[model samples]
Target chain A: MTIEFDAPSRDKLALEEGTSFTPKFDANGLITAVVTDADDNALLMVAHMNAEALMLTLDTGIAHYFSRSRGKIWKKGETSGNLQTVVDVLTDCDQDALLIKVRVAGHDATCHTGRRSCFYRSVRITDGVPRLISIDEHRHFVPSEVYKA
Target chain B: MTIEFDAPSRDKLALEEGTSFTPKFDANGLITAVVTDADDNALLMVAHMNAEALMLTLDTGIAHYFSRSRGKIWKKGETSGNLQTVVDVLTDCDQDALLIKVRVAGHDATCHTGRRSCFYRSVRITDGVPRLISIDEHRHFVPSEVYKA
Candidate 1:
């Protein structure tokens, strides 16, 4: 059976102390999902998940996301072979967002660009100009080689 | 000055290879901001930031977020004295989301619930029932005692 969320209560005490999982999806019927590497606590990638994506992840123990650009349910790493195994899922006090701990399988990469994490660069203001500096420059796999059929 | 976004290009090569900050905000002019502790890389909070909030965060070196419920620019910790000092801000490949690394001030709490982070509960399914478990149970401060003043 697909998972269903209880109706969110507006009362502060009930909302925080309640036992129901009432995710506050936005107007687009999407909730934010923040992913982190289970081993190192490094922020991996942030994505959106509809009810189907969330339910699938819960049911299958794999990461499923909703791709706004693709306008379809995304079984992450379905094409890249870098599937993510959900270790644990945590919801915030208000149940508006989720923190998903994952063990990334296959090349240990999460970014389509082959980076270990999507946040590979550090934004810096150097010499009064903003520039993106590559921090985690190690690519787990070459995108041209991976995404190619 | 408010931050302006570069036009989002659909060309995969250009979007990934280009060196401009072009965030494709949703119809609400909001981008998802995922925060992590600068010291430990632990996921701290997830919030939405308007262009004004983002520019102010960059310009002031402090975390500012747009409160959708309050419908205004929220200078974080303005009422709670828990100002977050921005350590670094990183944008993803397509620049639709942001990763903000910050060092929290005051009681080192980022959650209104007197917790270090808004995420304090782990969701699990046991015995065919979903339940919430308190994971980060350490309360750095008492919310009722702190927010009362």
Candidate 2:
């Protein structure tokens, strides 16, 4: 069965208060997805989802994304074994982006660098130039061994 | 003073571990920004920022964004008197996006609708069709009076 979204209503009130789930995909036919860990609510990653990916995520309760670099639908962590199980899906006031709370499987890592969250670095300005500082150093797995296949 | 970003590095290790912040802006010269409350870390809103806007935000310690629809730099809550003071700024593994923690002034609202957060609705699948349910109903201020200007 295919799940189709209704075209977003032009009326602002209906879009904000209504019960329908009409996501506004951008010109690239993708909507932004903000992922967070369900237990701690820490941001895990940010990605994009096409209609197919959104449908599959909602249908299967598994996170899927549109890989812009690969130009195809990506079942996230399919190769690395870190599949995300959806806990809650939320849409913002404008219904253009998504906030998905998820419980991660496998090594419980969300980033390719084997970190639990993609936001492991904090940006700080030193003498007017922004520098990244590693804030989270705990790596759940070794990337070289996990994706060695 | 002007702030410029170097081109993103092609090497994955250098891009991830390097201290330099070379954000990967899209073809539109924009990067995705995810916002959350500083105290509770509740997802507030998601937006985009151009190089100028990003620099202004970092330089001023105030949340600024690029309005795609208005085609200009937006000082968030400028008219509504709900200015967001930056608490922390973080970049994901790829540096294509930002996660900003902020403290909201005035009504303590981030969304234009006077809600404390943009993610007030939760999407759920019912009978194989996705539906949005209002999870939060607290309105901190009246939108009509706030944006009356």
DockQ of each: 0.58, 0.79
Model 1 global lDDT (CA atoms, 0 to 1): 0.85
Clashing pairs in 2: none
**Cα miss at A29, model 2 (Å)?**
0.6
- Tens digit per residue, CA lDDT, model 2, B1-149: 55678899999888898898999999999999999888887889999999999999999999999999999999998998899999999998889999999999988988888888999999988787889999888999999988775
lDDT of 2 by residue, A1-149 (tens): 57899899999999988999999999999999999988888889999999999999999999999999999999998988999999999999989999999999999999999999999999888888889999999999999998886
**lDDT of candidate 2 vs native?**
0.93
* Best by the DockQ measure: 2
**TM-score per candidate, in order?**
0.94, 0.97
lDDT of 1 by residue, A1-149 (tens): 55766667888777676666677787798989999999899988999898889889888899999998899999999988899999999888788899989999999999999998888776776544456677777889998888887
> Which one is best on TM-score?
2
